[model samples]
Target: MLSGDLDISQAEGLKPMVYLVQPENFDQLGQSFVGKLLDSAEVDGRGHFEFEALKNVEGQVLLEVVVQKKGERYANRLENENPDSDNYMPLIWTRGETLVINAAIDQFQSSVTIENPSTVNASFLELRDLKKNAFLKYKNTLELLQGDEQLLEREKALHEYQAILMQFADATPELFPALMAIKWVSPEGNYERIPEFLVNQGVKWSERYPNDRWVKELAALASKEKLPILVGDQMSNLEFPMVDGSKTSLNAITDGKKLLVLDVWASWCAPCRLENRNVLLPLWQKYHDKGFQVIAYALESNRPAWENAIQKDGANRWLHASHLEGDQNPIMDSLRIHTIPANFILDGNGKVLAKNLHGEDLVQFVANYLGD
Candidate 1:
């Protein structure tokens, strides 16, 4: 149970709510976390509140406690949001444990602290605080060193900042904190170290928490990094069910083509449909006869919607295929298509040329590739 004295600076005009973060959407932190509403508490004039129902949760689940005004949207701790206005803090609530939080509502994230936390929660707090401190210390240093003459100093500062995270991630044996620290510096922040961290860190977690849901998800991400998804890397073969219910591979479609666009989209995505009409269709019309082709792969569950979208958009000229699995589509996982409208331009021999080109860039690239 989360029982504590919440010191709301102005106790009256505020409402406090608690929510459980869905396991699948845990990676999308600070985005939209309006998950299952577990409970709400009323604060007295003295600014004291409690959630008795927060006791005996099934397991160690992620929770967000937010204090917002009535009818106000649920608040998250965004990096860009004003610190004074943040009304939320993340919690790792463990079963059979009691966490007492004493915090001010106005500065919820920064002011919140727990007394005697579980192992998971303790690690979480330590890493979270470390991240905040590092950001404060390094953000200005990096910015000030942005000039070409200070490139070495900037690189040194960047490495020093990342080194802190890397060392923390390596040392913190707790699952959530290690994962959180790893994500903070992954792909963009840590770049080349993604594979190494995933392998070394992932192997430990995989063995320790083998059947855990989040562990499995992170394992998937680690596997994706191993696959060749870069420009100039030769793409592996992908086979999916055609609209006519025939199996066709991507390699088979690229025969005798100067360039091919491997378009990954979904029927339900409005932006995808708009791109089809605005960019892809025009490019297709102009270059279809000149040996430029497209294989539009839809991550769709509804076959009718898939067929209807293509028909509605008058995009029947392009070859279309799907596994009819929507977000759970195997093709999505195989190609690391976390979000679509994702695309890759390919050469005749199946090497990637460019990726995710859209709008004027798409038009310019295709036109330049296939000239008159």
Candidate 2:
């Protein structure tokens, strides 16, 4: 048997109502059942009912509920709108409340806060547990780093950051906002290392949850970075055929060049073809003599189309080549080229300088690097 009480008081204007559920009853219901129960709640006229529900996976029940007024919009809007926002929904867990799940009645309030920004209070016991796990993982990794006498301090710090990120990845889905917070605080220079960790985590997550959209997105993001690294680091040793039917090594092609831009594109890709007219042609014309060069690697299954597109685009001024086998191109496979119109910029000595820079950024990057 289970029961609970919800109370709402208004002296004058309308205010949000509080819903409370006993932890014992919540634990008995299971996540799916509890989710349905919460779904049945009355929708107030204020656009949505924002509440927090606690669940125990093993117990299969909800423990408690905390209600608050939904923020004006969803918390995740920052990802698409601002690209940078520290505001994450807070999840608080008390003695009886072991898990905090936030839900909004309307789609606009989809995002939930992981930690209360207004109070800066870490009252949530679940947050403490996550932090504890992260600290333990960091300590273990730090010990390993200490044992390696030959490893530089810089390498140790990189490994330690990776360890902490792994802890965040292992956290529950509800704790994602907190994970994002940690990611935000991470140094930008570690993006390369971090993506590798994320890819591993994505693989693990995909295995655990077979058909999750978010998991797929995470995996794609990780895989995206791997493409450049594979080409710049591992495949640099191999020689490939140029459009003129002559063989050339990537190292030889880029020798002594201050910057080399690899444009992995296809004649069939509309965006790739479109950029030739609007973006690439102009930029190349302006920067070719300024120590910047483009190497367009076309992936066209049809040899004629590849040749035709090259001629039509007037790409003669730059280095253009194609394997004439679409996805079957060994270079494409080596680089894990999943999307068309991809690009990478490498500085002198074959070091990757920037990736996926498009439109204004691409032009600006060349200007900045060439001191224009």
Candidate 3:
């Protein structure tokens, strides 16, 4: 007897059909059992049934057969024709079917009793393909390692890992377990390699899946690490427009001054805004005549907010200006301003003296710089 479930709904108007025959007595079995079974049945689209032969025979072979109207080739063509289509349904395959059976076998080996011998035999075949994929990834990684001297070779290795990750992303939920296992086996090298790997993968990910969570997460990780993640050279000798609409270059701000404090800040930045209230204002007032000058660069995206902050905080006493474009501000980009509430204290002749000074530290820093 042969029995199994079949889903023909996706076939639309196509009918379900099957032919079964015994290899030993093909003519006899076909004329009797196979012909009789086809004569009594009507099948279309989707349905399930069970069957059993009435006669009890010793040492007799039984063959079960099933066929769906749609197969892998049809599904592949549909996917190829419509890239964004989600019409393909998951089907049992050599690898996938093996993974399912193997998982069950593993569970059974771990203590559960296996009442089926068919599952054990099917699991053995499934594991071979799983191992084959694992070996392929390993072999590729080794090949990548062989040509490490060339930059293009390293890029190729990075691409291989990225391709694997993309496959995992596109896989169905049922296939995820095996895909994840493959991903786990793929080697992720040290921190030095991480930046390059992420950069290459990030570009592909952004292009393919714009709103993917992994891309954002990877970007955040790279950003937080202070990696050279942003593609650009460090800004030097930048000229910025002051709040009064007068232009002042960084060189001019530092020129003829005993010490120049290039305070990079914004109105929206609570920390920068609060610095005046905390200690900077009082210190600046006390030290202005003692050769201290502040050139505050506002990195505010809003012009109104920048002006409002400067006025409200009484920051007028300082040499203030802004490009009014936040991160895109030419001066900030030139300075490579990664973190806010940052500043560079420069000595006479426009050379950097100290960077990122704040609070009482700024007072102590100046006192030490001036030998006070």
Name the top lDDT candidate. 1
Assess the local accuracy of residue 250 in candidate 3 as a C-alpha lDDT between 0 and 100: 70
What's the best-to-worst order under lDDT? 1, 2, 3
Off by over 4 Å in 1: 10-25, 28-31, 69-71, 75-87, 142-162, 186-195, 224-372
- Residue-by-residue lDDT tens digits, candidate 2, 231-316: 34433644667888988777876776778888888877766776676678887788777777778888877877888888898776
Give the TM-score of each candidate: 0.51, 0.51, 0.39
Query: What's every prediction's RMSD, in angstroms?
Result: 11.6, 14.1, 20.2
**For model 1, where is the 10-residue window of minimal lDDT?**
186-195
Q: Clashes in model 1: which pairs? A: none
Candidate 3 residues 1-372, lDDT tens each? 333344433444333433222312212211222212221123433444333331332342323122223343221111111112212111122221211111111111111111242433233224323434544574567565653223333344444554554444334232212222222223232223223444544454456555645445544543424442232222246687878878867777766678878887778776777776565687678777778898888877788888888888878888888877776777655664555677777776666666655776788988887667
lDDT of 1 by residue, 135-195 (tens): 5667779767664434435545655666777778788777777776676664232243234
The segments of candidate 3 whose C-alpha lies over 4 angstroms from its true place after superposition are: 1-235
lDDT of 1 at 71: 64
Deviation (Å) of 141 in candidate 1: 2.1
